[model samples]
Target chain A: MRILALPPEAPPMLRRLTSGLRRAALGAGALGVAAFAPQIARAATVHVTVAYYSAATGPYFKQMAAAFEKTHPGTTIKIDVVNWNNLQQVLQTDVSGGVPPDISIIGTRWLLSFVKDGIAEPLDSFMTPAFRNRFIPVFLKPGEIGGKVYGLPIAASARALFYNKTLLTKAGFPNGPKTWNDVIAAAKKIKAMGAYGFGLQGKEIETDVYWYYALWSYGGHLMGANGKVAFDSAAGVKALTLYKTMVDQGLTEPGVTNYTREDLQNLFKQGRLGMVITAPFLIGQIAKEAPKLAYGIVPVPTGTVQSTYAVTDSIVMFKASKVKKQAWQFLDFLFTKDNRVLFNKNEGFLPTTRAVAADPYFQDNKQLQVFVNLLPKAHFAPVIRGWENVAKAVIDAVQSVYLGKAQPAAALKTAATSADRALAQ
Target chain B: MTASARRAFAPRMLIAPSFVLALFIIAYPFFDIARMSVYHVSRFGILGGFAGLANFRRIFADPVFIATVWRTLVWTGAVVSGTILVSLPVSLVLNENFHGQGLARTLVMLPWSVSLTMSAIVWLWSFDANHGMINATLQSIGVLRQPVQWMARASTAFPIEILVGILVSVPFVVTIFLGGLSSIPSDIYEAARIDGAGRVQQFWRLTLPLLRPFISLAVVLNVIYVFNSFPIIWVMTQGGPAEGTQILVTYLYELAFRLGRPGEAAAVSLAMLAILMVFTTIYVRMQMRSAEP
Candidate 1:
């Protein structure tokens, strides 16, 4: 009851508090500026946050950035590498949050998904008639969604059979496998020599898709042109049977169910495997990780026709970009013959430009020549919206069959039903 | 104002910030997720009109989803029970003052210090079929003539994943139980020893009953964490060997993130949430009962 209000004489105290508050705010502001100085400086660069994948090709990317900035005065390219495995999710989050990169390089297979979601801007408006004619036809196919070109084809990775020359020599084959049958036969012999015949990834959808690439090359398309799930066809059955034959013949490891690119690479590096169907980029990894082993590359062996899986990286502009023209300019500069050659030659990827492909530098690089030769015969996976689901189903189906969880026919049937449903959506 | 009104006002004033924060952080997302569970929202934006309960219904009818739910239950059950069973004894042992007991406790908690993804990868490397340390060690010791493809076989993958889960989970249980063990008065153990109680009987009669709160806490936490664990299975096998290791969370991740089926993913998330809620309710009931005099 005796507690009296001191309001009449509180003005002095209030003034002191206000001054303290002002001083604190100023102090905080100063600290904030200091903390953000590097970011402010970083913002002035082109700031291309490329998903940081590996230390292997990082220097090359830096050189490309430096070269791009040098050619275009008053511009600097900043590459932000995201983890490769989380690249799609990171890009999606970036775009969804309205903080998308000016230009994002994404897998060709992902183009349709990004476009279908309407996050990716169609590049046709940016591409002049002259520039539109520059891309390889198939590389452009995967980047198109709903008859609109949504991305700029930067580079394509055509998968091929990379074999250990010493293993082949020890097996008395002297030369690497040529045809699918020859590969299978050579695999059997290689296994007899206490080495894995062929490193086939049979665990996940990604692993299974590699097998499907070979299957499709053997005249077994998963979905026929008529839109029926053709993976259950006679050709499909034949392809599965060939795989089963290989597994039974000790041509592949008994524990092929969980095999992955890393496992296959490890085996090849250790000289415990004869060959694996993988991308050209893995060759550089091998050269760095295990240089002692002599290796050879051939076009992916075919059964019915010559075909290898082609995955490309495309420069996709976000629909939310404030500067679309600048984004296009950056992409055009990156895709030019000179820059394209420099990027591809340094990155171990085959260039998307025909001129870059025909460049004497690529022709001279024996490793580059293998991918370049294969690109002509390469088949890009069907890139319709919901194709990711189809790919997953296909991968799962292959894993199911390999694990003996389901027969090839049964697995394919399940996959076909799921894929058809996904595609039909 | 009356004392009751003043008391009410005081509590309300105290809780106002928390209520507002919860409204912004938790309640908003909770309701949004509830809405998303039913509606078909694309990653870019809402594409279609209301699907009503179609997303939920689709999740139930889908075989892969059903399988994933079952696998999730199995994963949770295995990891939780296995973590409790393995950790209780380790905790009890460490409770006693023994030589290097502190070091042992630290070593047990070492796996917890590492991230789940890193632990899973290390385990994956160890569980490698060919040149893995486990296989090589086993073969060198003449125990296993040939290597076992731990992650390859459908039959073996679940157990291996559970093993990894248990590895990450046990330390938490051990740490919790250790706290409980320390809290229990030494007088109780002394009284039990005077009553001619052996180690097993002492544990069964006194230690366990008193540590019921800690046990329940550990179990409840393990169930929720294990149910939602994505990285271990995803990194090791990627829900493969034909999706044998495809738990609900991993499957939902693939559907939403990998396959771009946000609507279905949202549905799966709600279903998994409902499941965890039920489990939590049961746990709470058990805890309440054990807490009674």
Candidate 2:
């Protein structure tokens, strides 16, 4: 309660007014407490903030929440869905404002910062061995920092090359290009036939990830043992040079720097581009929007090593949560086999739970199986703080290279220096 | 107290409520940002130990910050001056007692009613390389053999953004100028004609001098608005294609949210606030001095 007392030296009318205001304040405060009493005394609400993966995300979570509420009558669930682009900003504001939700779905790359800031609650003690065994280890590893688990994998995905079969057949490599050289050769032939050979994504979110497919394929790594940026190595330059060459030779679509990952996918769906690399969610998008498109999946083209980028978004328990027990129970119920399978199927994400992986829906899907088989050779984002800053630097470098403003080696070197400075902060 | 002082105190007491509201609304955030700029803050704005001037030093050392400062100045100057030059002729024509003047005025101000972000998105689509109306129109007129990639590089993109800035800013300036025009009473042009002044001379001598205060007001307001404009750059190019189109406000956004360095972002913002304050002070003082007898 606020102290509304006036000083003893106040005049008669002022003191009278102050006392009257105090009485009014007391009356309103009493009414406020009365209004909130039932909320505090009855069912507890576990508020969850989730990222909108698709239109189905909100309704799917609401359905899960309702089912959980029915099973556990004493606890209520509240779900708030945010777009992926604004999730980080919203969470930061909510956390700093001291009203963070009980649970949130956050990018796995951000787990380190949350752990470092003591905002994430470690869920190891809350988990029994059976609960621990439910998750596939690879998917679970990203949410663990040091020796404790701070998040549970809610969704996981990996990237693969989605090649237009018709265009590839016309270019005489019908099964899709298996290597970078093959891609270039097929692209040249496709360009002669009045279509873009490769759909290069040179803009916006995941632009750096798109390039990392090439970098990892060519045996480059993100960070060294000392936790410094090492992407400026010889292999990194070579990988970038390969893309720059493609851009220069007109093998890619015109105005390559204007093409985001979504733009490239749109081109591929229109049959104007021969190949693009993207996640499995494109399969769902293609089915809904471009049903007549004939496309085949392949692993990211091979350089020195065949690799893909695996990523996950996880549900984390915040340290600020008051209803920890109820929140943990909700989390436990949400991760059940049926719930996992439903979420995976609705969002077109790869399975994160062991039981969901073995389900016939995922097991029988051939296009999904390609992504699953590539998982063993997938490279996750390195566990480091300030990874977004590094990605921004790399995205800038890649954009400049594609735009022909700077050479690949100089751009990578400049990016490495700036990224290291950002990482140092 | 003296009687005159007491008399002064009454009006001050009457204004106290609104004054306190303004203080709470404006000064609190100003003070908060100032404190954060001087302190060591975490990504989520948790203040750590006091680290004097380190945040300022970091931003000063950044090449992007320096480059963005100049770009912001260019953006402000171009947009503000462009708006004034465009609105002078527009408001002049609209002020004439011609038929359909109301409809013409409404058409000129239509873009103002649309939100800035919406206009930016429409322009983004308009300038799209593959399927934009601008390119189609140009190609149809036989202006080019190929469609131009307008947003691919900053060289073309920044100028287009400035044009859009000028377009959106014209309506408000024209409104101010129209108010100024009507206030001229229409008798001044008659008096100038009696003195043998030509039409251009009357505009130069009478119309411009009477419109001085309004021009100053428009410039000050637009400089502040255009300098802090976010969506025009953010929604269009996102200060991208290799940081080529970045301005201070957009760069500050990138710093605070994308890079998660709210402390340095606070420093950048405080720097921006100081710069605006200095500019407005100097400009207003100059205007006041030039207007003096």
Candidate 3:
């Protein structure tokens, strides 16, 4: 028989573990002091975290950081470039850890949450009339919430149809279909020719947006006047039903749920798809990858009203920053007319500033002009908490309908319920 | 100290350091999650006022969570059993001395060297509805008139995911089997053969009983790994074409990151830990009972 208890020798072993732990703690404390040493010596360090849009995004920010540092002595701009996929999670972690950057470029949709959390510094006090007027009014509207400006639009784009010119022309709509009915007619004709007709996106991020184009056209709003979800209403069902009908008729690409926006873009580039709706960046992609593909641009095909979705990414100063002044200076430097033009040109984003909009490079591009013209009739994603939840619910519902598992009305009702539950949380 | 007391406590003294390390590594997270599970945590990991059991109630109420729990079980069972079935034959063949044995072993372990994300990505491209190698090959071979959108629905996507899960798990399981095979003394088998035990009889009566411990280890470890597996399903389909292919872990990730509900996600994780604990306990109990005379 033996007792299961520590003997006299165990105390020394315990002392060893504690001593080792003390050494590790001392080492960590020394490293912490080393990390803070630079903070004490430097006059000010403005850390800016920007999302990577393209290969050019990092270098462009680094150049801006250098330029800003050169103009203002005793200040340093440290630009941290993060991938778009990880941007939100990184920001969430940073914000929670109480070490977020002085500034960040975030999706405008996320600005609502940032503002609610009191993490975003209100920009109203920093803006002069001249400085505010530098931006296009429509582009700036998305960054404003509850009568307070919290962010500045860093990049902007609106959606429109990119049609295969050869197919649409043979199908008797050379300039592309102008309405939902015309789209059906053109798609039917294209389907008769043994290729995909409409290129519908159903799998990933923008699956809900594809359906929303039709929803907005048919006079559906994401929320009711009372601020409850309204996309489950009649117009929304009609919009989804129309897409389902097209899928059933084989007028859109087969297995619509298998295709993402990128997949549809690929089909369009391969000249096997008649039409697809996407943002302005596809213009640059086409010029690079499929220069001879012969495509044309048009507004998203109308249902009862002409409508398209506009989206923007915003640069916001953090309320937690110790160096807000220096961060604002960097933002101002980056948003100058010439700098904006360079950024838009390099990243294929639409001009967010009035000065850059007048640039000849944008004005002369016929394909891009179509997207710019659609701005008057564009709808931005509504500023609401839990937008991702709404988006997931919508994506799931749309995919189910696209996969022919549920009827449009039934799926939309279920989604509205799920979305409401998420919003409540 | 007395010699008898020293013998018992010496082992405890040695284990104390590692026990403390395990507490830091595992127990801290378990405690943190347990706290979050009962609280109203914000999207960015901030704790609000206590909301006792709200997160767990929310998860239980969610239809997707219910479905994901069932699917996770299926994913673990199918992948683990399928892996054992495939690996047994492969490891048996590999156990025999043969020409190019090292090359065959290296080829079997080749996928293990590649990152799970990379392998999942390669599989994703291969199973793409169009312009994918599998679709192209199938079309060329006249086996399929049109390409199947393998990821468009759960029916095709989940099976393919299970198959990939099996493929990746095979190497690990086979290695375990080979180790077990090596441990069985040759003299025992020789004695059995001399006693007129045939190949089938010898294998059934000798090889299987000897391999019981390794098989149990493979089953337990693989269940935990595959149940929490994210990349293969996530990179391939992101639990989509709808949430049809969702398992609990993937759903937890979507909740924590995508939907910004870390509180609920913490609750889900605790539920997962509880399930694994219960399963392992029952499994070990059965194994121990069977081992008893």
Which candidate gets the maximum lDDT versus the true structure?
A: 2
Q: Looking at candidate 1, what is the lDDT of residue A342?
A: 68
What is the lDDT for A156 in model 2? 94
- Across residues A1-425, which tens digit of lDDT does each residue of candidate 3 receive? 01222232233234335435644555675777566444444677777889998888999988887888788999877777888878898888777766677999999999998888788999999999999999999888889999989999999999999899899999999988999999999999999999899999988888999999999999899988876789999999999999999999999998888888888998988889999999888887887889999988999998999999999999999998889888888888888999999999988889988889899999998878888999999989989998999999999999999888999999999999999888878
DockQ in order: 0.60, 0.74, 0.65
lDDT of each: 0.77, 0.90, 0.89
Q: What TM-score number comes out for model 2?
A: 0.94
True contacts kept of each: 0.67, 0.67, 0.73
Query: Residue by residue across A226-295, what tens digits does model 2's lDDT show?
Result: 7889998898999999999999999998888788888998888888999999999999999998999998
Q: Pick the candidate with the highest DockQ.
A: 2
| Candidate 2 per-residue lDDT over residues B158-178, each given as its tens digit | 999999999999999999999
Deviation in angstroms for A281 in model 1?
2.7
How much is the TM-score of the A chain of model 3?
0.89
lDDT of 3 by residue, B109-141 (tens): 888988999999999899988878999999999
Please list, in the order the candidates appear, how each scores on TM-score for chain B only: 0.95, 0.97, 0.94
The TM-scores, one per candidate, come to 0.88, 0.94, 0.93
